[model samples]
Target: MIKIRNPEQILSHGDAASRKLVLEIADLTLARLDSYRRIKSIGRMEGSLLHIGTRSWDLLKKRNVYLFGAGKACNHMAMAVDEILGDYLTEGLAIVKVAEETDAFRKTKVFVGGHPLPNEEGYRASKMMIDLVQKSGPEDLFIVVISGGSSALMSCPIEGISLQDEIDATDVLLKSGAGIYEINAVRRHISAMNGGMLAKRIQDVGAELIGFGISDAVGSPATGNIGTPYAAYKSTPIGPDPTTLDDARATIINRDLGERLPRSIVDYLMNAGPEGETPKSFPHNTYFLLNTLPDSCIYAKQICDEIGIPALIVSSFLEGESRDAGTFFASMAREIQTYGNPIKPPCVLLSSGEVTTLISDNSVIRGHGGPGQEMAASFAIAAAKAPGACLLSVDTEGTDGTTKVAGGITDSSSFQSASNKGISLFRALREHSCFEALDAIGDVVFTGNTGTNLCDLNIVYVPGIDG
Candidate 1:
């Protein structure tokens, strides 16, 4: 069960039952994505046959087995694999967002790094990962694990590309309100391990690679959540590809990354060669998806079942501006409460997908918030229009944007709460400072290290007599 750190303050701000239900769903979603739980149910070792997901590995036949990855959830995934392989586990490395320098991690080298942004720590970890891959033998069986934040956590600057350039480019892309796919397209080019380059390197060494992923984006293969170092989507239409000059030009123009992005990044993308992604053929490679947004929504609905309330899975593939999605959800909840046309009242509307928030402006040096909080704060203002409706949007990974809180929830009472604290919702929204605004009203959600990542999970709930 997920425990909200300030339950009293949280429950005091909104409908207690509604906030409780929201937390229940968040807990269920994380539980489903727990790396240990996932590995236990799907992986097993019997003699030489090691089963994970739908594939079986002939361990006795293989020479050496290696595990490596980068992500927020990589720690737990590494822990689970270590437990499963036991004495059979040859060696492993994982770069995670948080640190716990314990004996368990020593058994499988773990490095802590920055998230949402890459730093020197990430550079060190990524460099080490490159060294590990290069040193491995041809007959090695590489089990690559990937989850949200892997893009940054596994950063390795290509030649001529400084870490600062990559950081500036990433910062702009993130703040420019681009979707995961578009942001990935830009970042993959500068990265040494993304865009199938890692897979190509593993192939060059004659090592066989396999992947286990927990998607944190809208699409599967093309979405960049799948370890490009290990697997490729069989489907050509949405399969992986390197970021092209045309891609960069379009993204920059659309999201205005040029004005804010680093000059080095712009030059690299503009002059990038035609040699983008390598061939998609993977004779010795296989990949498996451990969890997805749609799968988690089913688990959330199960909780709704126990509560005897109608639950609707509105959109699992939601995307675009965080504020747009947030305010739109508020309006939708308002509609459900007032008209009850599409979905009857006394219900929970669930949607799972990542959203983006364009920084109000990078010119000023002030605190900004993540998409989840932007949506929730926007709802707090919009909630005044819909008295009975509330919205809770959170990143399932237990961090929203760069804030300490997981996310935020708001209802009709949110306006009063804000007024009581003398906080201006309009100003917060304009400044893109939902983290601070939500903090003022005691509505920020908390569940440290949710042990999973499948994008953002949103709940639009309206309480009625039935609920």
Candidate 2:
């Protein structure tokens, strides 16, 4: 099945052969990243016993089994758990970035939540989840599926902090050019349902907790033998958090966001006692690590090998300014095509990481876009030097930046294509409106929740000069 919704539109023009190859690799890689299939493969129910990986839970022994999830890919993750648990599942609630018509659940209630920012609906769903945990006891079991964007998707600010204050604070931190970890340091501390707070509530109620998560942090290794219980799982809302209150304090000081963020958030983090700190350890929780940021690149490389195409996983630690990363990737394509330096022609280069765009002044933003769109737009301008080169940059979770589209794909002819339409790529990047510019030329890539969130996945194809 094709993950890219508009493949025909994307392959209509502009180095069709190269674009087709890159899209094929992307589609295959995304198919493998499906959480629904992954969870089902490792979990099965027999009679009254429920088996997940190497562990099994007897439904007869448990009073109630509840499923709670929050993230961009929570729809599929929650669905998998709901289907496997079936009649034994007491109730389920999940907060997702997008609720698709394709989503089918046996008993779970889905709540559409905001991403990149917190909203009232997410806060409501989070409160409901907290209530569900509070009502549970020692015999009850809580299963939480957490992925990236949960901090925003499962928004329940601390008592002293208003939802708007958390939202405003998140907006300020995102635009501050700080890394995701640095930003989460502040957001987690001010949140009631994030950074191990959910797990702490379950622990307080004397309930058993089973967590399934996808780690998007850079430097995380590929998930191996997911059937085995993970011992080092941390971060997210349902696991032990590695970030501390001091980390939160340091983020504000280092980013110089003391005055930029809401005063309530600043005051809460500044004055919060040690008891207010997030739980740093949850040794009793049985967790499974599904995928990491590096897994995307690793999977792409495998697809290339199966297809008999030479491929290189350039890096899984890609970060920094989005547009600049695009230019750098484009330069690499030219070097590979002209000099055959890294690998021969007709090769694929894959990378996965979180690239960010800094927007200190929101007034400069003329249109909606994300880091993936900016990178693709920047690649288009520089790719004009390298013929037959095609690049696809997407935020694997579907939406990129503030746009509905996942990201953008650009070929060597993309620059001239935009020029013919009287669109300037440079201006698009400058104004942070690459979505509009890319959409005009049918370069915008659309994938409505590809069932995984592994941050940004950049795929580039550099065909032979003669071919």
Candidate 3:
């Protein structure tokens, strides 16, 4: 168990309390990440295969193992595998946003790349992974490690789509307020490796493919872990083609990706699954280590309760548009304050999951933000209308969206600060610019790269409504 400073102390106006709250949230988030890390460690090859199903053990014993790890958490997961598998790791490749020359990772090939957006480096690393898969024969074993950021970090745009096209499309979709499923759906359609396409590519290599996934999405590990083409399709849109780059930008600028995804991506997505009957080839053996949001929510609830606040565990799998989700949570807080129904006053409402933002053409050239910040800012806007309510949203991974900070917190003062500065919180949110809003009020929550990625954590504290 990790100890966090009392929420009350942190919420206090004193600098010590404020700093303590930030530190405590950071600590709690890190602890959650660490717990997941431990699970990955224990699930390694040498760590008691006895508990695993017989089929998994049989697959493990096979030789000629080739490994690939992708996503934000991939570096740590790969390092843990190295610790456990040691010399048995015949050959492996890891793609992460932050790969360092640490002692634990010295033995493996680690490629540092971009996240939330695919860069040239990310594309290069992804191509290397594809090459590795293509080289493997029937006798080889392929181990693919996947986590949250894999969709962006392992990006390989398909034919007819330039890397810039994909990047531009991604930027639009993000600000367009699309959910993760929708954003990823568009991503899968445009990519060579997403939407279980990677799994399909190596299906016939005769190698026993073992996928170890740290699910950042909701359930459906294959979909959540490796990027399901179907889910991505579900999230994207079937539409009229955009004639020019300007048109494409306009489509994204005026419309929400949440409202619709690219027609090309959507069409390809619709043709997936058994009914659509594309390729049926996939890894026979796959394992998902943890779907962690539930546990994190439980932890948050316990912490809130310990602090003498009634805490409600609303849902661990919260999803949908960032602004809507924020509004929904805000409504809950409002309800408690007005009616005291679901939860009384002096209570907390906690949720975990991924929220998405959509981008349009106007800001595509100047856009910079991620989901966590969007969620925090959206919640802040919502909380602004509900007096006496304070909310905090963060990405447990310590990196929210593309920024260095995890997320932000909001109180009544957040709105006042923005108003005084001639900044409209709503306008900032429309641009998916939470950092600006939070920064203006000194509300940004900064926790540098916490080695774990479970999902987002949201806590809404409603004061003095219970009694």
Candidate 4:
């Protein structure tokens, strides 16, 4: 009966309960991180490693192994693999956005690149990764480790597209309030290694290739779940013709491009080939593990229930626009408080999922913040609309985008403090500066790099006991 410390009190007393829930969520989030690390610890490579139930270990034994890992969690995942594989790792490479010098991979080469947007360094690193895999022979093994930010960290533009175009397009899709699937659809079309193109490249290569991924998407370990070449191909549809530049633009106005994907992307769908042509099946030996999201939600729910608060474990696959999702959750809080139908009073609604926000055009000059902060701000506005509800939204990874705070919390005092400071809550939301507003009122949650990412966790509590 592991319990979260006084969730009801945390909701009532802004100072104490706010801090407690923040720390509690951070602790639970770390548990998931530990689970991810444990997988690598137990799945270590000895002189030879065998698949779950295979007679042969030769596929992984005494081979020249090359590694390529990308994303915010990529560096950490790479570090774990390096520790487990050791001498068996003949050579390795990694690309990350925030550059941190580390001796984590003793024998592997490490490189830091930009994220959320690709830069020249990211391009160079991506090419190097492909070259490493290309060099592998039948006696070699290629291991690709991918995580959340890999799409940006491993960008290699398609022909006729410049890095700037890709960046601009990415900025548009992100700010367009599109979902992850839609955004990645456009990205797969423009990227060299995305949408299964990367897998196709090594399909005929003599060496065996295996992908180990950390899913930031709704489902776990599916094709394109981590932006691997296989996923890119499977998820996106290939159109009859490569969409011309003009055609792509026309589609934007005609369709809600944010909701619908581009024709070229659909055309290139790996599953779509010649008419009546059977698709090539993935290798029988390939393994895609389901290790994401669920553990964190279950643990968070346990803590809430133990604290004597009725807990509703909502969908682990929550997705879509950040602000809209915030509004929806805030509405749920209002219903629980006023109607007492969802779980009566004295209850916590817990949820985990990735939320996306559109980067504003003004970001060029004013710079917008991350999705977690936007969620916190939007939740506050919605909560303000309903007087007695308290809500907390945070990225489990501690750092939310470029900000140091994990996320923000909101209650009655949050609105009152805005009034006292002569600040308009609406203004803060418009500016995408929720962290600043929450900070002024002493409500921002900071956990300092919990060393893992499992999307976001949100908790809402309604006070008082209801019949």
Candidate 5:
């Protein structure tokens, strides 16, 4: 069921054996981390009795059971709940980054929302959700599913701030090389829906809230006891925001984005008092953490164990400049293949986290690319030092940066391959356009809606020097 659209194209060149193995592991990981399957396993309904994890709710007592969700993985998460609730559900609305033709929903209305940048459709959906929550009463039960990208997917700016202003601010913050936490700090305080504002709206209406979320935060530990209700969950629209107004102001100042970002955002964060701070806690709501960043590595290692391949998890908190990280990974590959310091040959190096690309000048951009593409292209350039070493970098959610492709795959021969095609990989990197370079050599990965979002997953295969 887990299919890569361009597997043959990807394996046509490079270390086919190594590429095949990497693809297999990645596909299996995507299947295992599917939100629909995860939600179904813990949630179900037996007649009028609804069960989610350890808790069971009698629908006869509740007036209405409404569902709302927004994120990159919202489609699968919302679909699972809608199917489970069946006729007992009052209504459902899901704002997703992409809407697949195969996504069959009975009770949920799907909206294709914008990601990385707020769009008009998403803004309208956010307004609709706000109206829906406001009209509901105390007897209603609200079930919310949220994941990574919700900040952009669910966009409803506070009073006096236009949607374009929020979009402009997001662009500035993302390009500033600031981390997600810092970016969320500024975004949370300015949004009417984000940063627990939606949860607050539901809370004020006296409706019971139950939230399910996937944490894409770097350095997040693997989830445990997923069925148990978590009380300390924070961030996103449904949970309490851990960020504050001070954090927002600090990010703008620290990143020197005051002059670059929209004036409305900067002025609001500066002029607004304590009342502008996002809600910090929601004591009454119940939350569940499905998967974390480290879980991707854990699942990958399990695949390696089953296949009799030696795997070492380099790090789950990988960050910093994307190209630099690629070169560092290539160096590590060389060290392992030559010195045998970390581990022997015929081994795999696995890492997961958010690696960023800094694009301060918009004019420098020549073509489409993302952190994953840049990583693989940079690896291809440096990987020549270690023959036959192959690397695969992807945004686990199936889209990397601004492209439709999952990411890119490259090996030692990729540099020469590009040379043969008269494509300058170095120039491509310089212009922040690795997608065209990788695609020209049939190294681009394609998987539409991977059904999960866990930032980036990097895999490196180092064969024996003799092999």
Candidate 6:
């Protein structure tokens, strides 16, 4: 499901040990695919009982079965679910940023949409999804698949807020250094289908809704946005998610998005419409986590352990500025060499989280690279001090933001490679065009849609102490 482009160049161009670590990280990232993990997580339908991640529904008695959702990888997740539901699935609808997979979905209609911001395509897709949900009856069982990018792919702006208004707001947030939680809070309030509003609509009509969430929002215990359609805000989120109002307030007070964004966005946040998103409780339905980024990292760690290498999980829920976070990760490698603390060298540092790139510079196309590339370029420059160090950063979903490439991998000598070519790494970083710079130096990682959206995967290899 995951393919690394220019593998020979990427693996052999850097420190061999870091290449192996990259191989391991890439291998494990593919290992956690929905096709593979779903078997272990979702039980098959046996006559009447259909088990899905600790929850079972009596499908034999149910009449209408509808499926609907939106996300980056919901297409693959929906396909996996379709295989299990088989003949029972009546009709389905889903909106996805990428059409990664198309199997096990003969009955489901997939709509291609946009991400990081909503577009007219997503606007139309969301209306179709709403219609599918609204038509569901008491006898119907709706299986909802929610993953990252759902907030945009499945958006239908509330009254007085146009689709363009929502799109402008999202663009501002993406560049405002706002995390997924903050972004989603504003999203849930502005969207006609978020913050459990969809669930409330279903519950009012007495239909059943069950969800499977493929988390991409810092899955250190899977915090922040629960992909929204899992009846978000049913209980206070385990992740540090602000309420719809609080998030708007925080964005204005903390990030100053009020002045940076369009006036329509500011006015909406300031004065909520009467048809505000105050979703009633959805107490019965449960959201199941099929797998997470931590699970992927741990699986990779197990492989390293079996191969007689010491490894450490730095943090599964890392967040902050992409460039800064990359430097801090390189620092961990430096510490292993200097102090011999935190599991020493000849070790692998594993972490998974979503970092933000606040693209304030307008000299270049802000969509040139994702957070992973920003972090990877920064790490390459910082780890120049530790020749024994190397790292790889990738968005598990494959494409990061607007780029076709997943992310990048770089060793300590990567900076030298760029310098030798007269490519100023910092200049590319400043322009938010790391993709162009990394591509020139052969450090870009290309995994064309792994058919999953967990989060970002970061692995730093320090190969001085032991093997």
Highest-scoring model, lDDT? 2
Per-residue CA lDDT of model 2 for 285-390, tens digit only, reads: 9999999899999999999999999999999999999999999989998998889988888899999999999999999999989999999999999999999999
Off by over 4 Å in 3: 1-26, 33-36, 44-62, 100-103, 219-283, 302-308, 364-368, 378-388, 417-427, 465-467
Q: CA RMSD for every model? A: 3.6, 0.8, 6.9, 6.3, 0.9, 3.7
Once model 6 is optimally superposed onto the true structure by TM-score, how far is the C-alpha of residue 276 displaced, in angstroms? 1.9
Residue-level lDDT tens digits of model 5 in 1-467? 37478888988887888888889888888889998889899999998998989988899889989999999888889998999999998999899998988899998888888888999999999999999988999999999999999999999999999999999988888889999999999999999999999999999999999999999999777988888898779889998888889888899899999899888889989999888888888989999888899999999999999999999999999999999999998999899888996999889899999999999999999999999999999999999888989989999888899999989999989999999999999999999889999999999999888778899999898998876
Lowest summed lDDT across 10 adjacent residues in model 6 is found at 233-242
Q: Model 1 segments beyond 4 Å from truth? A: 3-6, 100-106, 220-245, 276-279, 465-467
lDDT of each: 0.73, 0.93, 0.61, 0.60, 0.91, 0.74
* lDDT for each residue of candidate 6 in 132-161, tens digit (9 for 90 to 100): 767768887877777777777877878788
lDDT winner between 3 and 6, please give it: 6
**Residue pairs with backbone atoms closer than 3 Å in model 2 (clashes):** 370-401
Against the true structure, candidate 4 reaches a TM-score of 0.79
Query: Deviation in angstroms for 340 in model 3?
Result: 2.1
- What lDDT is reached at residue 322 by model 1? 78
lDDT of model 6 at position 162: 88
**Candidate 3 residue lDDT tens string, 1-467:** 14232344334432333234334544664665552365453454544341222233443555566678787777667776666556666777878877544426535688777777678888888898788878877777776667777777887887666777677667666666556654554565556777666766667566655565555656432223322212222110111111222333334434534245445544444444433222223425445454344656766666655665577878777877777887787788788888886978767777788776654455333344566666656666666666667667788766787677677776645667567778777777766677766666666766554555767877777765422
- TM-score for each of the candidates: 0.90, 0.99, 0.76, 0.79, 0.99, 0.90
Candidate 6: segments with Cα more than 4 A from true spot? 1-6, 33-36, 101-104, 219-242, 273-275, 364-367, 465-467
Clashing pairs in 1: none
Worst 10 residues of 4 by lDDT: 232-241
Relative to the unseen true structure, what is the C-alpha lDDT of residue 306 in candidate 3, on a scale of 0 to 100? 60
Candidate 3 local lDDT, residue 229: 18
Worst 10 residues of 1 by lDDT: 221-230
The C-alpha stretches of model 4 lying farther than 4 A from their native spots are: 1-13, 47-60, 99-103, 219-281, 306-308, 358-367, 384-388, 401-404, 447-451, 465-467
